[model samples]
Target: MKQWPFYCEQECEQYNVSSIYAPYLFDTSLLFFKAVSTALDLYGGNMSFYDIVTNGTLIAQCSVGELTGATDIKCCRHQMFVYNKTPVMGRTHDCYYNIGKKEMAYIRQLRMIDHENVNKLVGFCMDGPVLLSLWRYCSRGCLIEILTNDNLNINIDGFFIYSLIKDTVEGLYAIHRSPIEIHGNLSSKNCLVDERWQVKLSDYGFPFLKAYEQPKSSSEQLWTAPELLREPEAHPTKASDIYSLSIVMADLVNKNLSFENSDYNGGADEIIYLLKSKTSRLIRPVLEPVIEDFNIGFTHLIKDMWAEEPEQRPKIDVVRKIVKEMNVGKSKNLMDHMYSLLEDYAASLEQDIQGRTKELVEEKKKADILLSRLLPKAIAEKLKSGQQIQPEHFDLVTIFFSDVVSFTVLASKCSALQVINLMNGLYTIFDSVIDEHDVYKVETIGDAYLCVSGLPERNGNMHVKEIALMSLELLKKIPDFRIDHLPNEKIRIRIGMHTGSCVAGVVGLTMPRYCLFGDTVNTASRMESNGKPSHIHMSADANKLLTEKVGGFVTKSRGEVIIKGKGVMETYWLLGKQGEALLNVDE
Candidate 1:
């Protein structure tokens, strides 16, 4: 490697400059190297060096093993100068002295030009074998990494992809328009994505540095223009940069390496060989059929950019114009485009949540219907609200029990389905009558039906009136109900009523039942069992309450009937209500 001489001719004339300048320069270099080495050694290879002159600093000395993505590139932090203000990232490489000089020469030329999509050159450090070139740091990393990373949650829609292409074209056009008329080497790997996902062009205008760099693999050669690949001595021109741009655009769209879907299956080496061959057919990256959805204009633009002949390719400014037209009425920039997309996504998410909520409400309604049929509305509501239920006592209540006459005989005469139909039809009529009164149907066990009023929700003396009217209505409906299976057979129900205090509560957990307890319920059951079919039998308490308290019903006494398990008790046969019939009674 060549080193610049520290002493001039006039300084040599005035003093023993060789001895003084040589040792001083050599010692200064050695001392600087020793300081960096000590920092690295003390920290176990984690160290940073600050350049006092420019206020540029390297945060930590990155090792070859720590390098990600690329082998030759070491990403480090740097600042241009104290006056330059903002810090930036630097890509460092150990290159031959001649290559470093060549790159520095080109960089000096680029310092005057500026563009938004171009990575701004901060400064450079030529320390020993290390040649570091500083450029603005793009936190989001390179285009290739963004394209290939599966973990990155990027929305790569048409607008987003086109925005990147437009930015890339703008950068290229700026370079073409400047003194640095060409980016000899342009590729997806050289294009970077900033924090805002804006694509900025890098690794340009340093042909000498690129010359001594390791030969790219055949895969990487996919971005090289065919003319350059064919003619090794040809330098990269504006036309060649456009070709590379097309390859990068293809990678962005496909999210794959360039020419990944080419029909040529023999790998990158074979494709390169074919591309360089004079007689071989031209091969290009396969643009997916889906690309047509972006617009045919974009498709045609790419085709023209990478035309086989260098002269046939479009100019960077022409490409920029077309991209601008493509984006004219659209979002002004990438951030604006992303904001619009996010808003659309939020709207879609809200719609999905609303639809799901509506479905949930409908399912809850179905569950409520099933629960209401199992228990009273108040008890069901309490259970739904996660309230604990305890046994409740009613001071006075009317319990009613009823059963079909000769139900067992009728069931034996009919098929299982016919028996179900018979019961359903009979109960349908009874249910209609039950709905008219303020009573809760407790349960029905086979042929027996049980109901009560003023327990779960109290109605004072109205229980007697509600139960009397309910039982009378049930008896009236039963006489009119005919069994569907036995059309000629008349249906009859014997109903019994009792008025007394009782305890009611919900029981069990799996399939709960609201049950009434105490002698009142038993007495009511016995009254129905001991009475004749089609008759409304009432205990003395219920008869007294109905006649004296309610005063709407007429009754005849059935005195001193021996009740099961309760010795003899006075009972009465409820004949009929006021202005109603008392027909076919055994008086």
Candidate 2:
């Protein structure tokens, strides 16, 4: 036997255990254990060793560990541990190594046993006296843990339970049909649950290894066939496996350990004695009352599986067919059931999300309307879309300024409430007229109203036309706006407009205002202050724009008047449309 340098006596002395032996590495060509990198003391004083080895044709590494722990899963003499290996790039075939003449025979046979309900054997480690077999890791642990756990809270229906039985039967059938021929040791503890909740059979075809393990107790021999119990040296046959499956099925249906509900007064020792003596009647787990409510045919089938005569037991293939028949109209497969549950949950979540989305849209609509009232529609839309409203420069725009002719005199004639009522009525009329044009109302200070056109959206020279038409309409409507307290007293307003470049943008955070900046706004205000009652005053620029660009309006020059800002500036009095009079009195 050839040994690797990793097993040198000097390095092996580091662990303080016995030096590496010679026969442990016999058959140099069949050697699987290369080197031990780390060791873990698993439950029950079992040792788990890790090593890196070549996988397939690639340069990748694999983890090989021994199964040692009290809680570790056991199937006969073979203890199982997790075997994870990363495939090397460009590798076509899987990597493998021989353990020994006896173990390699079982390994070769196990390699041919490929089924969804069977755990795959990746590799094995036989370094020194340690014998470790590597199998795929089942994340959900063993079926014994699931059946015994009280806090797991697994919600299983009758059909779902039957599905598990059917999977077990199928797994057994695969083993029986393979070269392995029969599972010498079949029990609930050997059944593992994968991440998909599918049951897989583990720990089979290793009788040589089982010889080194501890002998099974009478309690653990509950699944052993009557003939096997009588002859302790006899190997498990197909009939004994069938009898064992019946006990496992009973555990599934009863949700308890095998023979837990037996009527025998004595313990498992007494029960084993009776079965072996052949003097007492054959004893099995008593079927619970709930089993009667389940398929009566299923209960009868279980009885046939554990029949006193080994020849009377059904074959693995027949058991699978019977279980399939029992699942005709039962629940779907485990994966399908899980997907159905998730789909239903997702549908309910989608409905809740849609309801919340509808409420959000309605609230957003209300907020949009409120914002539009404070700022221009375009600017409000930009703000809602998370865009910064940069101040815009308009080369040509029309600004309109208006106020009551004598708001103080009108207020002095009425009480404060009457004055408020009058102002509300008057502005309401003007606001309606303002809406008839494209001009946006900028602000309202007491009796003064400010508006602008050609921004935040531009309409070129059309701003002059829009503002001029709106001013004429306002002048035409003011006489009809009588105070509620003094109905007989007619009201009049002074209106002014100017056309020039100005900067407009939203200002402030609390209550933002769409403010207009530049001398054009001030000149427009001056025109409104220096105007006559029931008249529309216009700056020279506005008058020129109204005459040349928008010709439908009638305007007469007010001549050069001494303005506060300028020495003498020419202005105009805006009349009305082409043929209409400036004052349209409602008699």
Candidate 3:
């Protein structure tokens, strides 16, 4: 691009010597690239489009990168700077540049000077020996100042001295009507009210005064008009200046200056600036007059102003006309005018109702997503619909239970988020295996998961073999879990399965759940709790069913064992894939 001096000289030629001046302040000690780089990294990118001039030489510049590289861009600087030959405490916090341009200087300047129609012009440093002008700072901060200030508790009056508003408009008119439009970086900082309630526009940092051709590639083009945003960009034209002013008008009408906190903006460059430009002028009139001294309406106006399309906006003169006509002075009269002006209030109210309804639908979708994460979608949906899913009593359901070994202790080793991801990962493996077989998942209680086949509806003789195969697959897949948060723990699942008569039905009124009863469920849970990791335990009936017909598993009879409340029962361990060397079934 074109160098600084060439551009400056060109600007001087076009706007006369009064609008342009060459830098004379010089001190190499004060001119360090570190300070400039800090500023660039902080505010440099799109918002940092301005140049850092110190002394008689240009030290460095900050420019936002292209869109593709935006996310990787970290625009923060922590370099130190020397002001008044003394070290300033922190690096220049620059990210607030674009939207907070005027406010940065205005805030400090307001405290230093009391001025009407002139935002407090505090001193600014050029990252070198020389100092430049900065807009003033106000003691009470900006409009949001009193709103959020805990100690002050000052109630904001919307009237804000109409004369002050008029003066701010006059200053705006002067800036826009100038030979070259002066785009006041009109942030809350740049807007100030002296003790006398006089309003002034401060901080001319981003304004293009007089006329000068832009660089072959202009960095500011991102927020500029599309024609100016192209390569070999057009000069910063009057229309662009008007576009920026529209944003300033919007700030006044909306009360608050920044749109950063708004969720609607979504980081779209052209759209953000455009929305800021439209403000109160575009607000549905039916809703406007009813807005009391202070309410969410001001925030709503800010959103409408900065809408994506600039052409859909009203002109400044037209905006001025609306504001003037709506100056009904009295609150009751304003409310009366609200009914007759613009569209009907009922329609706007209906729109709000529709918007809320849409939001509720989205919330339900998200809740369903979260629920699906916790339980299988089929079961989760059935539960949500409030269906009485009665438990199935069957003579042949294959019940399976698996528990994460020492899950409670492992949970203590990790963060809440880490534990959740780890748990989900383990369950996901089990879920995948279950889906391959003819089985339906019951529910997960803590770290334990339950599943059944052969009722609700039965898949016949395959239920026992299917559950056994699923358990084997689960054991084979166990070691894949490697959670950084729990390095010492290897995720191991202990499984237990049973095949016999059991009554299954939905239980409870408030938290209605489908569960199995009788010895089958109790035996299955006992098998998991008592079994070793990577091993599957089965009741005598389950073993007999699998070994007699399937004939693949190596079964080891563990003799009669006492099961809670059911007395001594015979059980066997299926030790390996079927037909491999048996694990001494009688031993």
Q: Rate the local accuracy (lDDT) of all candidates.
A: 0.77, 0.74, 0.55
Candidates by lDDT, descending order = 1, 2, 3
Error of 3 at 31 (Å): 82
Runs off by more than 4 Å, candidate 2: 1-108, 126-168, 176-318, 326-392, 401-436, 440-450, 456-460, 474-496, 504-516, 525-537, 547-575, 584-587
Q: Which has the better TM-score: candidate 2, or candidate 3? A: 2
Error of 3 at 491 (Å): 3.5
**What is the C-alpha lDDT profile of model 2 across 1-587, one tens digit per residue?**
22443454444432222222322333222234322222121211453232223222211122243543322233223332322443111101122334578767777888778999987766655652445556665656667776777765344556556767888888888888888788887899878777687998876666665544566788878788889888857688899999989988888888788878887778898888887887756688887734333665777889999998999999988888888887677556888876776687678879999999999999999998898888888888887788987888899999999988777887889887887887788888878988888989898999999999898888879999999899877776777766656767887788888999999888887787889999999999999988888888899999898898779888888888888886689998877788775643221
lDDT of 2 at 573: 86
Quote the lDDT for 455 in model 1: 73
- Against the true structure, what is every candidate's RMSD? 16.9, 15.9, 22.1
Model 2 / residue 513 / CA error / Å:
8.9
Tens-digit lDDT track for model 1 on 484-569? 65888888888899999999999999989999999999999999998888888999999988899889688999889998898999
Candidate 3 has its poorest 10 consecutive residues by lDDT at 16-25
Instruction: Give the per-residue lDDT of model 3 (tens digit) for 411-500.
Output: 887888887898888888888888798777888888999998776666777888888878777777887767776676798777888888
Please provide the root mean square deviation of candidate 2 (C-alpha atoms, Å).
Answer: 15.9
